[model samples]
Target chain A: MSVTGAGRPRLATKKRPGDTAREEILDASAELFTTRGYTNTSTRMIADAVGLRQASLYHHFSNKDDILDSLLSGTVDEPLAVGQGIQGVEESAVVKMYAMAWFDADQLSRSRWNLGALYLLPELRTDRFGSFRESRFTLMNLYATIAGGVVQELESDVSAGTEELPFRLVETIVNGRADTENGRGSAGLHHASLIATAAVRVLGFPGDIDGIHDRAVRVVADVTASSIFEKKAGHGQ
Target chain B: MSVTGAGRPRLATKKRPGDTAREEILDASAELFTTRGYTNTSTRMIADAVGLRQASLYHHFSNKDDILDSLLSGTVDEPLAVGQGIQGVEESAVVKMYAMAWFDADQLSRSRWNLGALYLLPELRTDRFGSFRESRFTLMNLYATIAGGVVQELESDVSAGTEELPFRLVETIVNGRADTENGRGSAGLHHASLIATAAVRVLGFPGDIDGIHDRAVRVVADVTASSIFEKKAGHGQ
Candidate 1:
């Protein structure tokens, strides 16, 4: 790609691991943005980190907003697709819910940078990120629908409040990850599993959770092996 | 009290509703920080918004961070004290959980500005806000304690995942409030009540929720009436 200036002369500095120069810039941006704060990270710093010229970086992305949008989109799209796939499957609501939360939480927990922490950026409330917000809204709706099914199976008014809690519950992984990253606390490696079970539990799913967890694990693995999750090594490589 | 610059001549501009000049500055800062963003807002803009000279503004706060720290502290203290008070009272785990959440959600919901939205400000990661972060940490621990009690009352493995979730669930009001403010989706006026109920339900509280709600409502009102919450009428008033 011309943006990467592939087959061009080398800048010859410390290079980051990425299949392409664009990916390298994204990887650098992710580290700097999350660690240094998004408002504080600059395009020049990203270029320096990736050993690319600023002109070369601009060719791939128009501005810092583009890089942020691309990184944020990569985080949401796979989970939305995986959740949608789990929805049509001939599985119980518990499995569908658990699978969705588990897969979503796993990806958020495993992302190279805790980009999920950026969801609350005041900048995101603007029209520029309408699509990201909508995708997230769709994801929330999917969670509510699956949670609604779980509530129906119980035939009780357990989670009679907002069905949005399941989605909200899974997102705590974002906060937990941020806390751990900040050295405030350690949310053990099992946080994804813990948060997944808690997501359904908040919906009052009072059945064999271990069974649901087992099935969900398989569901997540199937989706991960599919072409969807393997969509590149992903943004931050 | 000197922060108010008492007996000083008034400036002719738009005035915010506050009993004191210090509170007025905080009120304006909360609005600017949450809406325009902490990083983007300058003290000069805040001074202009509140009709104060930049030099006079410095008398009350050293910098933007000082104003931010004061605004952030106001939101956390009342909830922490109320939760602590609830712990000492003879109440069921459900009652305690619901009451703590309802009171917290109410304040977070009713705040003049969505200051809770600023919690994720990347600037907060610094050690300069350590006391504020420590206070928040204490409040979270209190939530976990109340949530743990609810988990124990069930005597089931429902919320074995994380006691931290009940606090996390209540905090979603922050995100929900932001969403509603942005005109994305209306979370409803009853979001505080709904989220408080869900916060407990997440811990598997399965009996007589209406009764718990009734008691919790009364408890929250008592705390609101107390001199503790009435302390200075809060910042961003």
Candidate 2:
């Protein structure tokens, strides 16, 4: 307990409404859960970090598992939504793949890659996360569609091999970089271009590489600008 | 405890020499450490898995940290040696990269991938693993050298970008596949070919992709055949 000058426990500000309370709890838990394993963190620690009385914390979340569910759900839904949006946009198949890769890497960077990395733990592998796994499978299939389309259009001899391999390659690049201590810091605007470029090359896209890089950068910039504007307008908030 | 027909604790065979005992302990610990995590697993559990009494286990190693050091050291040394051998081999830069990637993916697959995944755990990120980390760094630098040579010889406008990215990409594919329930069973000769193909492309190698893929397969097959012959001759055992 933090004590004020008079040695009394400092009062927390008046509690927020349930939605705000839930958001704050999730924001705090995501960081804690990423740095410390979910099992190692406790509800009490989360409550303390968020300045909520222990009993009050339950108003927003019933338990740690509930918070994890929310966190994992939020992390996947945005990129997958963005990916689905890209498919609706009229663009070349290669451009769409670059746009999705760029968007996904940007989203992962914003989430502090560690949050996405939580799935890697064996403890989190259970039937309860089956929905989460399904959502991810859907997202990868979306990527594979864009990649396979390009391969079919470009070369008849090559099959683009397997959908799973390309998807896994893109994932490997993202998560592998995330494992580095400085990975987050290094994932700036240009890094998204690097990721997109690498993604296409791994898919065996036989296109103009330089042109793809330029278009990917523009797509990422436009999306980021729009999202920033939305946040500023209090829509995302 | 495993129950026997007579319902008494089964008598373990008399203790082997220290070398054999250490190897058994490491073998048991690798599986337990990978599945249960190093921190969650106890020395007692490891000893039990290896058919050693808890006290007798201590005679071979001081504690869990020592056991972990041995396990990590063994895992890194084989691949590092193989990587170094590739560096010394007189081959084209692309061939060397493919050989290194093929050897690494094969070695990691043989070790069940969990052995490499242990480095991702926060608890293992300590000074004790400095030598292990250095050996890995050396191996990556060797890869970067080959990659740089390929990029320079092929494209004047292209930069090698970051050496770390390609290395991490390879690791991500290996570990990501490893996370699947039946990942080990899925890793066969064709998968190694797929990994090598993706690896060189990600490095921006402007060679004939088919030619590189064919050479990579031959290199991997030759190596695998030689290793099996050695094992049959009781050299590797």
TM-score of each: 0.91, 0.79
Tens digit per residue, CA lDDT, model 1, A126-217 = 89988888887888788889988887876646635556777877777777776665566646423677777776766677566788889988
DockQ of 1: 0.47
**lDDT (10s digit) by residue, model 1, range B92-118:** 888999999988888888888888777
For each candidate, the alpha-carbon lDDT, in order, equals: 0.77, 0.62
lDDT by residue for model 2 (A1-237), tens: 122222223237523222455566677787677666666789998887767766777766788887887777766676676666667666777787888887776566555435765656665556666777677767767877877776765552433344455455445443544445523333322356567767776666755778877776676556545664345323211
Q: Candidate 2 - CAPRI tier?
A: acceptable
Once superposed on the true structure, which residue ranges of model 1 sit more than 4 Å away at CA?
A1-8, A158-161, A186-190, A227-237, B1-8, B158-161, B188-190, B226-237
Candidate 2 clashes between residue pairs 3 or more apart in a chain or in different chains: none
Regions of model 2 farther than 4 Å from truth: A1-19, A156-162, A173-179, A182-190, A214-237, B1-19, B159-162, B182-190, B213-237
Give lDDT: candidate 2, residue B83.
Answer: 60
Top lDDT: which candidate number? 1
